[model samples]
Target: MKKFLKIIAIIVSLLGLHSCSNDLEMATVTKPEDGVFKLMSSADNVTLEKENADSQTAITFHWDKSWYGIDTPTNFTVQIDSIGGDFSEPVVSELIDNEKSYTHAELNYIALKFELDPDVEGQLKVRLKANLKYGVMPVYSDTKVISVTPFSTLNLKYAMPGALYIQGDAVATNWSYPIPDEQTMVQIDDHRFGLILNLVGGKNFAFITSSSGWSDPAYVAPDSTVPAEGGEFIPSGSNTTPAWGGTPMRSPADSGTYKIIIDFVEGTYSVEPEPSIMAVPDELYIIGDATPLGWSTGPSQKFTKVDDFTFAITIALTEGKYDFISALTWSDPAYKAKTGSEPLMGGNFIESGSNTVPAWGGSDITAPAPGTYTITVNFKSGTYVLSL
Candidate 1:
């Protein structure tokens, strides 16, 4: 029995040693920094012809094969950014199948997104990025600059929204986001939306695809220079453009009703004076503790129309607070009591009657020394003046 036990111990020891010898060894390999790769461009200056936008390639971008420590397929892409930019925020190109060619239409769309004016000289910084290992090591190539002149027409892959919504200080909610339902634009057709809005001049507004949140992509004025009325618009938000105003549509400086039309077909927008000022009362009046009406909101002191854009009224005002309203009702659009170019869009001013426990009202302008004063409001210039 002792001899059998000795034999069994020897066999177990031999099997354990063999298993350890067959196991694989492992170690960490530091990725090398030098001689990663280089990116090259076919042309330093490419003039994009509008005629070739559909059928021709603008330029060919290529890069050398990248070698990581391990034998793994690498993902390569080219990033585009404006010249002199930090490259901190860049638009990455889809380099599918490792192809580096870009069509004129694609390049032109990118140029427009970067705010490069068409038919004008612009510079784009291009660089190559390679992911050697997923979520781990990556390498970058030196940036190459290319001068390009994009065409006027831009064709991008941005999907159009089925319905459009607008909100801002100029429209409903008075610049508050998560806009109310009243501000949702009426769909005119497949790609057009027309809405007659009482816009307070001097306040800026923009359009959104979804009314549920502001984080969704929005549309803004095409460029930095915003027309007082309206003009062409472009896509905004981080998903669309890196840097565009959250609300770039500036209303007419004069507070009045305007018909705003947005055309997704042409990627354009227009704002014109509407015949009917449905949202805002045609005339404005004064009502408050300072006014003769005494906040009764029944028979307010009305302003005389000087022109389509101007109104004037000379009335007796005691020392107190007052505000301008378009109508006798407290719910119509009115001018805030503050001294600024901003006009209150919709007056949701809640009035608590004498029987109510809590009272609520809109802001009122303080009278600067009560007496008779002549007040003039100019919508075009977006200014109100009080002359004694």
Candidate 2:
């Protein structure tokens, strides 16, 4: 009778093990072969519109959950690369094991990284990356190609200029031609340029696309009027044979750090107080996925102060986003991605500061890719440059 009971217990244990094995199709009873999964997209080609970027989905990518040799929580990363580029150095967008979809802005941001011109269709490759726990190698799904037509971030209403500059007695320059770097206005967007400066109150200033000659277009104040705070302005075309006669902007009654945002799309400009008396802090640090020490709330990487208002650093960065902090914790006095620009990819050297913004909490600055980059920030001018 005892032997019969022992045999019955062994049979029950065997049945339980088999049930668990079936649940974990990838159970490592022996070294299991990697499981396969099919990846599919909702569209073969998509035309991206800026208006619909935030509210709509550009495309949806669904896939079967991948099976590694272990039964653990797996992470899925969607990668994108230029067509025929293989999977090397693709832009990464993370997804959970259960969720699958890509937003228009998210995909469009990746498409632009391939240098796809706005309003033009470009092709790219997509793949799924599955990561497992216990240090096992992550497996990847087969690749698929898609064509995308993306619109420019710049306003389509205005003729985009190569660059913009501010020249006048109110700024560092005295209406000089061939504008210097210091007086050059920071490109804010498709039709806006801005500058933060200690204007010489009561002096006059005007905007210029170039110092080429009298024919170079000039943006001047409307009717020689200066609003009590700030208001509308206009651009002078090159049609006038002689030099322009319209009034340039008059400096405010008070002299201090002020922000000027020139908007070509609306034919207006705005000026206001900025920085809220925040000077260049003595100690500045960068904290984010781009740095050696990632988003840990502990200490972060510091920058070498080149001068009173400038800071610079050369460091190796992964493809991630970051921002500057004055203290050890995420609090006030943080230098976020310049207002009106992508945190990760702000051109080779673009300046960010308009509307006195980048608010207290702004988007983190984006690193172009995984590489060694030099970041230089001029707090006086509220400008930053990222270069590889």
Best by lDDT: 2
State the lDDT of candidate 1 residue by residue for 1-388, as single tens digits: 9999999999999998877765522122335463356668789998888886778999988865634644456777688987866767677875434558888988988887676777898999888777654645666778888999987773533445766777778776875767665577755433556666678888878888777766456888866576776667877766655665434788887887676777776777887764333333378777788888788565437888886555778787788777776777663345543232223221112122332223332356666676666777644323355644
Worst 10 residues of 2 by lDDT: 347-356
Let me know the TM-score candidate 2 reaches against the reference structure: 0.49
lDDT of 1 at 372: 60
**lDDT for position 349 in model 1:** 22
lDDT of 2 by residue, 1-388 (tens): 9999999999999999999988777545232233356568999899998876887899988876635544567778888887856666688877666446677887788887676878899998888777765535677777788999988775533465677777788876676566676666666544667667667787888777775543356767766656735667655675643445567788888877687777677767777766543467887778888788887434337788987667788777897777777667664656775443654534212222444344354567777778866777766456566654
lDDT of each: 0.66, 0.69
| Best-matching candidate per TM-score | 2
Judge candidate 2 against the unseen true structure and give its global Cα lDDT, from 0 to 1.
Answer: 0.69
